[model samples]
Target: MVALHRFVVLTTTLLLTSLAWGETSNPYLPRARLLLEELRYAEAARALDQARAQPGNARDTLLEILELQGVVAGMLQQPAKARTAFQTLLVLAPDYRLKGDYAPRVVTPFFEAKGWVGDKGAALRLEALPTSGADNLLTVQVKPDVLNLGRSVRFHQREAGAGWSEQEQPLTEGKASVARKATRVEWWAELLDERRAVLTSLGSDTSPLGALAPGAISATPAPLPAPAPVSPLPGKQPQVARAPGLPLRTVAYVSLGLAVGAGATGGFLGVRSNQDRARVVGAPVDEAGLTVGLTQREAFALDARARSQARWANILFGVAGAAAIAGGTLWVLGAPVNVSATPAGVVVGGAFP
Candidate 1:
């Protein structure tokens, strides 16, 4: 029984990890492409929707989704949607052009959308400017000034890997501040019309502008001073002194290993509890309509065990998640780390020797 449970735990962990990786790898994009090739535009559109909904899609994946959405909308005679899609694509890639041969119906709307953006001039263009004489404060400016349009600018800001928060200000002011405590900030600005409809956006949720807080620097540990060379007595060798304290990287690895073990144990218990529940529910009934495979007392006992195991499984899962987060944080903050600032966000790299 113990061996079987261990096997189930390992199998469950692998299955869950693979499923998560599959989602991140995007199974819908190729399916959508196939559907599009088959001229099943509606099905293709649905697949594109699924692709858009899936998190962690890369920039190329987003561009493809917009491209397909525009084409699918045009094929379905949804000119407004097609125009909107094309316009968004154009905003992301100003010089983007239709690559493949397309019908006039599909081609016309795209050019019209291009013309619309061209006429807007700098109305859609936004810039984030550091506030003068203010720490951690940023002011947004719209080219050609959008205050006359009676629109509002909404700023979305967050620390890396954190949930976004919105701050809406009149287009006239364009005042928003970054969190002073944040080491790295990701932000985007959206122009909203009177009805809160987004007319144009500076950055998107998937792609945001990243900025490091002023005076915030990556913590790099200083090298330790070498110990004085001890003069060895005749025929005696001096031993090298070991560094004190446990390595942060080793602690991180241990935490991660514990997290995986706990998660697997939880998954196995959950599966076992579900099986027990199924047995209790599907037990054979005798001619008297009473459960025969499991006695009434046995059914009650099994139900209680299932519930108890489920509760413990949930607790273990929670612990696993917390441990995983702690491990990842430690890994990122460990010494000998390299922090690279990119337009999208800050990337931290480290390794144990």
Candidate 2:
């Protein structure tokens, strides 16, 4: 029973540690499905991806899976697969659209235009170079905004390219890729019109300032972004270097353990000494009356003195042991044993032998 309980505890502790590292991938199904119903198809698909990770977590009937899959396929513009997936979803979740709010009808193609900048997912903002004009090649500047990367010119006009959607300008897209890797991308907007275009740049971090030219077509970028600050988690104390050796904590705990051992030893010795003295076998110094021969009263007095001295020694050992153990534990736990300022944060970590 004891061992079984210990096993359970160990498993739970490991599970908790994993959770701390990342959220467990379950319970995302319903939410993902709801997102799909609400037309948040992309996000829903991503959610379902996470949910599908756990083994045997696919409790949904195969038909239900097919249904959601179909919706996702359609939303992603995979018509062939969409047809198949919808067939499944319809069979399994017949009243999905009925149960939840859904769009009344389809509109013009949503994928009419598309672009990405920076990372794959970062959308490039587009605008018809109204200010620049079709006769003009709008020059977009790229800057390295990453911390410590510097404020130097990473790229400039002609660094980024303009073109139609891949479907329309596959050749241009191919050409644009030639130099993309060299620059820090800021935005990617459509140059469809001489005045207005779509932007796929700066991502969520950037301001959604449309083309400098007016008669803009977009609603305010769906959501304005919050200001960018330095590191997010704050007040996390800096760490420091320690004297070369085991972590101070390690030294501390080991010392404490030794001290505890010493304390125990000392206490045992003290009691033994007292017992010996009482028996007169190893009484401390003879008492005052015992000049020539020792008397029982003198022996007893000497024993008591010895015992008192031993007691003090044991108490000292106990205190030292405690300090060592405490110090060692802290070091092992990775707490800064010798925290001090470096600049923004103290640097810890060094070779240990």
Candidate 3:
């Protein structure tokens, strides 16, 4: 009897230890977390694995098996396994934001994700944009994959060696044609600034640029030429820069000079006023006539300086206003002004906004 009791006790103890080792959450979880916080991922993962293996462990949503598995797998540099673990984690914890972790992977060659607009659990794929004109006819290709794009594009041709996005691929003899495919219709073409439109369910595809709409952008998949770079961003240049139609477009140079001189006038007024006050205060009352005369002269000088600054400001605005009207007139006559600003000052030499 004694022998049997001892044997039973030994077996029970061993079984308990094994069960503890396999439990989902060890009491030392906090300590393991501390280790993880200190960048001790390996040790923390080992601790977590032991905790998870404890037999007859209570189901703890806060410490799910998948959660522990993901952390362990991530620490092991097994990204594929880690993602599997995380997907399982999502099945258990649906409210969490795993999209941040998976967004980059979604658009890769290996990730074959899909969604459907009409059927439940169905997924859509990438689709190519349609083309009809000579500009896009040969350059555009239909992709077998349907990419749900609400992006719109306008039809425009960029001259070769300038900035055309849709380009001619080198064919047999000197003739080149734009290359395209089902997976990716890789071409770039100049967009009509006025025609560029976005296609969407809201149906905003009616832009003046033309029929091409967008959800995804069609690219050359190559660098555009540096000689004719893309247009600079709108509002990049100052308003004064775009105006070049006045009699005094040349006088923008004067406006810049005027602003600087106005600040100088303020400095001069301050300096002269202080010096004159001292001179009058130090002199005798017997020289009241001279003092008064000197004070009058100083006041007139200050007034003249202020007036000169104001007049310059007026001239600057007046000239700019005239330029705007004249530039518009020239633009209507098919001669546009491309006013440009330079570090030296405003330079009006473009063909215009």
Q: Whose lDDT is greatest here? A: 1
Which lDDT tens digits does candidate 3 get at residues 1-353?
A: 99999889766754564354344234655445445545686887776665554533332423244455565555555546655555533432332332222212211101111101111222211122455443434222212112222122222233323333432222122112333322232233321111121111111123212233233365547677689666546557644433434534445445545545555655565565445434433333333222222343443344345445445545655655565555445444333355555545566554432
Cα lDDT computed for each candidate against the true fold: 0.68, 0.40, 0.39
Q: lDDT, candidate 1, residue 96?
A: 72
Across 1-353, the per-residue lDDT of candidate 1 in tens digits comes to: 99999889766765564453333367787777667777999999999898877754554556667878998998787878988888877665555766556654466566556545555652346677863443776567765542333267778888867898888777665443434436577888776555454445678889988766666665666789999977545554333332322476678898899899999999999998888766765666556443355554565567668767887899999999998998887776555645554545556555534
TM-score of each: 0.37, 0.21, 0.21
**Would you give me the overall lDDT of model 2?**
0.40
lDDT of 2 by residue, 1-353 (tens): 99999889766755664443333334665566556656787887777666544333321323344445554754565655555444333322332332222211110011111001111222212222223332222233322221111111111222235322221121132121112222223333222211111112322223322232223345457777888966534655545555644466566666767777777777777776656554454223335312224454454455456656566766767676676667656556544334455546555454432
Better of 1 and 3 by lDDT: 1
Worst 10 residues of 1 by lDDT: 237-246
Kindly report which residue pairs in candidate 1 clash with one another: none
Which parts of model 2 have CA positions greater than 4 angstroms off? 1-250, 277-294, 297-301, 333-353
The candidate 2 region of ten consecutive residues with least summed lDDT is: 106-115
Ranking by lDDT: 1, 2, 3
Off by over 4 Å in 1: 1-24, 122-126, 138-176, 179-353
